[model samples]
Target: MFDWNDIRFFLELCRKGRLTEVAKALKVDHTTVSRRILSLEKQLDAKLFESTTRGYVLTQAGERLLPHAEAMESASATIQDHVGGENRNLTGVVRLGVPEGFGSQFLSKDMPSFQALHPEIELEFVANDRFVSLSKREADLSITLERPRSGRLISKKLTDYSLRLYASRDYLAKHPPIKTVEDLKDHNFISYIDELVPDPQMLYLSEFVASPNVTLKSSSIVFQFQATVAGAGISIMHCFVADEHPDLVCLLPEEIEVNRTFWLNTPEDIHDLARIKAVTQFLTELVDRQKKKLLGVLE
Candidate 1:
């Protein structure tokens, strides 16, 4: 008979790609993950991973076990949802990965309300633009600019937004007149400070700007916007974020525009928890309510 715990550990290892990464996701120690993997491999009598400094690579047996484990995950979720009866007051944590822009511009302001209404639930908002692997349980929910790779997950197009290049009104005053995209080459650029480029929006630079000379690199869009507003440099920001900030003005009104989509992503097993279901429903509703606000960001 197969030990269910072994399967669970194997599933986690396959999804996460490394004992270290899995340990961090499970909030346990690397040694624990290593022990679990070794135990599972020993029981199955198969090599499941090829360890390296970067991470673990799944072996053939590990790959073969993936679909079965995912099916089990789906089954588990279904059973839980059935037993929970779709209750609204869900207790437990719902880890949320939000782009820094949305976290600051919209979600943060309304989060208190979500907390007040659902006191039993704790919201873990991990601010990152990088698309963390949902299959690995990096987060329970994620809001991203582009659609993620399809798998055992449920996703929705939350909203369509845009990015507009802008600078502090005072900085614009100092900069040359912006009439075309070519003019932007002369100005200092502010960009998200990481090489982990999963965001399709950032990839636009590859096609548009042949050589981008970023003056400031920040991990947070809010901070990037702040720096731009303080005359640090010019940046392309979600129009909604730049619109209300009184200090910034759109540069080259017609040249710098991005048509982007906001997608809400979650694991397929999300429906199993009553609390997750409530947040999922509320999140869908929340995005629907602000359709215009998101659409206005790029225009």
Candidate 2:
């Protein structure tokens, strides 16, 4: 018979992808994590992971075992919360994946308030430009630019936000005046490297300009914002972020508005968990409170 406790190590390893990280998270040594995994694999007579230079990659057996193990973990948590008389005080780690700009510039400021309300819930923000896989369990929940077409997931349209072309006062002063979209061709522009953009919705430059005088390119929206702030060149930026900086000026807002939606997604299995529900509620309320700001309405 396999030990139920061994599933904890297995899940941790699957999420972290590194023995040292799993060890640190569980307060155990790396060897102990490895030993538990090996023991579990031996008992089942199935290879759970294959060691590689990148770390341990889950084998077919591991993939098959994941959902069952996660169900067990969820059940254990539910029992602990209800039976231990701690249902009122929600406690667990919720890893949220989000786009870098929204996470850092928009949500980061509001996170402390949520933390204050749910003091026991640990929040991990996996803020980056790439798509986080719900199927692979990269995060407990994610805020995606596009609603997923298919997955064993629960998703909703969180909010609709706008982006517009912006340049610093210093940059506009140093270059030609952009009275119309035609004038944009004369100016140097900062934009994403074509190959690196994770989503086509991010290719805002192409929507208006056919041949842009591209000077700077980066995969990071934060870096592009910083560069635009430093007077590098005009670049498309989220209105919520750019509008906060008095130095940044929106150019041709009526002609160049780009609207996009953020979808909140969670694995269907754990969507009803107290911790996940709390964070989802927090996010829903957060976006709702800032609806005007997100839609680029300044009032």
- State which candidate has the highest lDDT: 2
Q: Clash pairs of candidate 2?
A: none
Worst 10 residues of 2 by lDDT: 79-88
After the best TM-score superposition of candidate 1, give how far the Cα of residue 90 lies from its true spot, in angstroms: 1.1
Estimate, for each residue in 1-299, the C-alpha lDDT of model 1 and write its tens digit: 56666677777777767777778877889898888888878888888788877678788888887778777876776676567646544567788898877877888877877888789888888888778777777788888877877767788887777777788978888878777777777888887755655564565544556587787886667788788989988888877777878888877656667788878887876644677777877777777777666666333
| Model 1 steric clash pairs | 162-298, 239-297, 240-297
- Stretches of candidate 2 exceeding 4 Å from the true structure: 15-18, 52-60
The Cα local distance difference test for each model comes to 0.76, 0.91
Q: Which is the leading candidate under TM-score?
A: 2
Give the distance in Å from residue 237's predicted Cα in candidate 1 to where it truly belongs: 1.6
